[model samples]
Target: MSIFPVYQDVVSIANLSKEQLPFFMRHVTVYKRKRLHHHDFAELALIVEGNGTELINGKPHELRPGTITFLLPHHIHELHTTESGPPLQVYNCLFDISLAVGPQSDPELSNLFMNSVEEFPAYTDLSGEAFEKMKRIYLELFHEYSGSSPGRNALIRAKLTEAIVLYIRSRPSFPVPGEKSLQPHPKDHFWEMIQYVHNHYMDDLDSTLLSEQFGVSASWIHRSFKKYLGQGFLQYIHTLRLRRASGLLIATDMGIHDVAVEVGFESYRTFSRIFKEMTGITPSEYRASYAKTMK
Candidate 1:
């Protein structure tokens, strides 16, 4: 069995109700370093006190009071407390990606969840008025999440949205490489298409299928993907599938064929060819290399 951990939403978050939005918050103190792990839900953590190091996707960043780290689904990360410093304390909030990029969400807000190949940094340092504002929102979010008041869910959503907007505002904006600055498109449903693919990548997806589903021509879908995402539809789907397959190879004991099938490939040969082509290693080799790292 693989040693790495992959946290699932159903297992990690508690008190989730079908009738209510999926959100959880807690005040946590880290005395020792956590194991390197990834989860299938989005996380926003505010450093409340102490000092630590956050290693995310193989990059290390210092964590101190007023620092906020945003982790998307499947981002491998861990937290380490300094030996001489006090424990790292933070307000950790977890929620479904849908909460951040739902159908009703604004385009700018929805872009925040598209971290597969991000144009912005994953974590940002907030200070002065920004820190104070975020702290207040987090406090209110905790209260609403723990309380049974009417419209609590709506309030929680509003606060979360506010927090996200504030975080975005705090960051320095940059144009996407090879593309002009993004603008809001009232009729553009690209984000909705992206979200749909993210949720259903394990299913058979193609331009024709997506075109039919979205009531647009296949060529339009292809052009939108190329213009916005810098990749074709098939490429995007393969990237998502490969990412999931890689995680499974490291975090589960599923067979190679099963892993491929789990991520939507029908033929083992095709899966192996594509896996090696993209990752430059066979599935078994990838798993074995990760095992070596653990040892």
Candidate 2:
């Protein structure tokens, strides 16, 4: 997942009567894809119908119907569909790690379910019979979450427990890695540069320096930026600097010229010109407007 999960806050996937209900289910359909992100909760996603590549930590894995994947709290992933590819329909069941906190008095069932989750695959492509079973279990869980019957929340946990057992029985070889390794891996040099630019955006960073630091050809670096991030390095860095400068303006009383220098602009005039071009207001005016809104 090139995009980290810091952008989106905790996702409200589960609906529970009490605040402590440990399970939640939501349907996710991807038509116009958004940025890749990671979050603080583990999620189980079943692809009911779709064809695409699920990019997990910069590596691409093929996804089709009956595909089930378990994502750790820190897994960075995004679905990349072809230009004319079919839209994806997936059941995303997100729950906290605390869901596995206490055993439900049936230690055997708890062990089975928790073991299944701990050993779950990053991507599992189910075969004919197994695929049908997975799909059915996912549907059952979705229905349980959608209905308002008494004890629906408790029923969701039970259905999910059954689903995990069914999934394991489909392939008893628990804890074994699937075709794709579950180990977290580093991104390639291009993304390394992208990340470096993000971390050091306030510095006087550019393509030549980044290429030298990452030891890749400058043209390849430029191409990689455009290919992966859909923008040149300069434009991306400018956007980052603008965002930081705006934050500082709102959060601090720094002068406009100091803010420009602080954000690595050569002069306030250049900063103001570009800021206006991008945001359509002078820095001071933007801060003033923000202050008024706060008041």
Candidate 3:
């Protein structure tokens, strides 16, 4: 028996040879969007202006401005716009990872890839200043791509490099608290509170304030931190403080008491005790050892 032929438009830029160009970008406008589809290439979609539901691996998320996603090969997904809602518009940038195979083989560049590619979340919300920075990059990329300027390839690579570097260095919205058995549903809220604490770790951080701000149960907040962060909330704060103190010890000539206060320790006595407990050495001893090593 003979089988009938089937057809699908592979996710590739038309008129482009894979051997020549590995990067492509386009502005997309859709009144009615396509169904879930898989692609062999990776994609980065920046929501320009649209309201819709994005289904990724069967989970749905409300997509709006400042929403960005990095799609991996074979990740099944699609978008659906509301009838009375806004139009579905986006800038979709596609690239072949094979283009960077040689660079990625080096340890330093591989580390860059790890942070920019492997460590990124599936989707991120970029708002306020972060969103503006992304918009600028997108605009520059578009302008350079559309113009037939000299050293075009080099400039395009520079734009992409800037974007990737920004992505890697941007502060993460969530916590990657090591590998452990997740406590269950509702426990994932650890990251939301974690971000807030990271921004205010130098201030007073307590379960009560976190619960009040996040609207979750105080016990749940504490439990989430304990399970996901592998430590209780207070312990996490102390860890951050000690980390800052260590940096100050090495990078500054600040006195021990000043370093303690700089890192938010209430008093030098409490700071010294915690520092010794965490590092197994007094703050002054750590500073002395570091100074000697630098010589």
lDDT scores in order:
0.76, 0.67, 0.66
TM-score of each: 0.59, 0.54, 0.51
* lDDT of prediction 3: 0.66
Residues 1-295, model 1: lDDT tens digits: 2223344443224534334576778898899787666655688889989888887654567899998988776666678998888999899888766788878777777876564226676788899999999999999999999899999989999999998888777766663333221223445455556656765778888888888887889988887777766677787778778877876676567899998898899988988999999989999998898777666
CA deviation > 4 Å runs, candidate 1:
1-3, 6-12, 112-117, 174-295
In candidate 2, stretches whose alpha carbon ends up further than 4 angstroms from where it belongs are 1-4, 11-20, 32-34, 101-121, 171-295
lDDT of 2 by residue, 1-295 (tens): 2322243323322322223455667788887464577544567788887687786655567778877777655456777655688888888877655454354435676575566655654666777988887778788888877788888878777777676556656644654443443333344444435446655677888888887797777887777667666667677667767766775676556788999998889888889998999898988888888777655
Give the per-residue lDDT digits (tens) of candidate 3, residues 171-267: 3745444333222244344444554675577777688888888888888876666765567778877876776576557655678999888778889
The lDDT ranking, best first, is 1, 2, 3
User: Total clashes, candidate 1?
Assistant: 0
